[model samples]
Target: MTSLVDLLHHPLRWRITQLLIGRSLTTRELAELLPDVATTTLYRQVGVLVKAGVLMVSDEHQVRGAVERTYTLNAQAGDADNAEVDHDKLRTMFTVFVAGIGGHLDQYLTRATIDPLADGISFRQTALNLSDEEFTEFITAYGELLARYADKPDTADRTRRMLSTLIVPD
Candidate 1:
């Protein structure tokens, strides 16, 4: 089994995590969503994530003499306290995380038709002044708000959006 950092640091694997952020999906569904990636490579990355315990096989069933597994992000996958990651590894992971966001933006911009306003796309950075305890409270409240909508099912009136957050102390 690979360490979580080693398994999720790759661009493709990070993207796989992004795709599974709030939903359960099979390898076939992932391949269809990422048509540009070779099916073999995608499956390999998924296997790595599964082995690392970042992804859990939530469901499995037989299909045409083969087993199809539905994978969901592990509940504790993002809990950094569980792992003893070194400073260098943490820095590298942060860099990869930001790069993944940039890559997604690049892909969105390359699309033939895009209307930022209509699509409700926005990105902005702001400085916040808060005490340590207040900051913790803020994060907890923010996470609770996100949890309310994170697991929503797909519907005709809903559009999937990526939300990324980064904090840097000054």
Candidate 2:
């Protein structure tokens, strides 16, 4: 069986997973959100995820003789244990991650609002020098901080945000 990261090697699946993490959306909605991908291609990728038990059809309704499915991440099944640090898998993941970042940035720059300071936009890469123990402790703390917000209730006062991190030994 392909690992979760391997399954996510498909850009469409990766993007779908990213979008569905905390919310549900219909197939039509996903098509609208990912206009660049052909509807057929998107559907194919989604089907793979559904088969793999990562994406669940939360709801379905008949519309004009057709059934529309609303999908949400099946948190339990979608969960992937911390990825093993295999070179090939890491390469594939990084390729997908960088492509996603490029696509998002291209779209974001054209938007009407892009206040770097006001919106807290940042793009910087820095090297870190730390003992193995220190690195382990730092990453562990970071993960805990993220877990603290995993179930934060949505509120009008808070806007959705994406945090992308790619840490590799130098």
Candidate 3:
């Protein structure tokens, strides 16, 4: 079995996490939402998440002789607040995270019409100097700010956005 970080490092799995963030979804429904990805692939990745306890089986029933399942995000498994990971795994996870962001950027740029500025797209590095206490406070506050909007439902005027953060000691 892999850690939550390792399980979530893949693009599809990461997207699965995002989709399951605020609601429950079935594999068939996920396939409908993500038409580009094959259903088999989604099922396999969902199985991995379930095995790692990142996703929970919230409901299930038999459908046409097959068992259909609905899954919800396991908040505890998704939270990596105090997990102690080795340096190598951390580095690999970071690399994968950057690669996933780059892949999304590439896709966005290749689209026929892309207005990065108007779309609120941003990518930049910020250096923050703070003591341990200040850093903890800052992180907590930032998380709280995001939590306010994390579970918002999709609306006619709303668009899903990805926000990634990285903090390294200098």
Query: Best by lDDT, which number?
Result: 1
Per-model TM-score versus the true fold: 0.90, 0.74, 0.79
Query: Candidate 2, after superposition: displacement of residue 81 in Å?
Result: 9.4
Evaluate residue 61 in candidate 2 and report its C-alpha lDDT on the 0 to 100 scale. Answer: 99
Kindly indicate the candidate among 1 and 3 with the higher TM-score: 1
Candidate 1 is scored at a TM of 0.90
lDDT (C-alpha, whole model) for all candidates? 0.87, 0.83, 0.84
User: Which 10-residue window in model 1 sums to the lowest lDDT?
Assistant: 77-86
lDDT: which is higher, 2 or 3? 3
- Give the winner by lDDT: 1 or 3: 1
Q: Which digits, one per residue and each the tens of the lDDT, describe model 1 over residues 71-170?
A: 9999887576446778988887888888888878887898899999998889899999999999999999999999898879978999889999988898
Over 4 Å off in model 3, which ranges?
A: 9-11, 59-68, 78-84
Q: Which residue pairs show collisions in model 3?
A: none
RMSD of each: 1.9, 3.3, 2.9
Angstrom error at residue 124, model 1: 1.0
List pairs with backbone clashes in candidate 2. Answer: none
Point out the worst 10-residue segment of candidate 2 by lDDT: 77-86
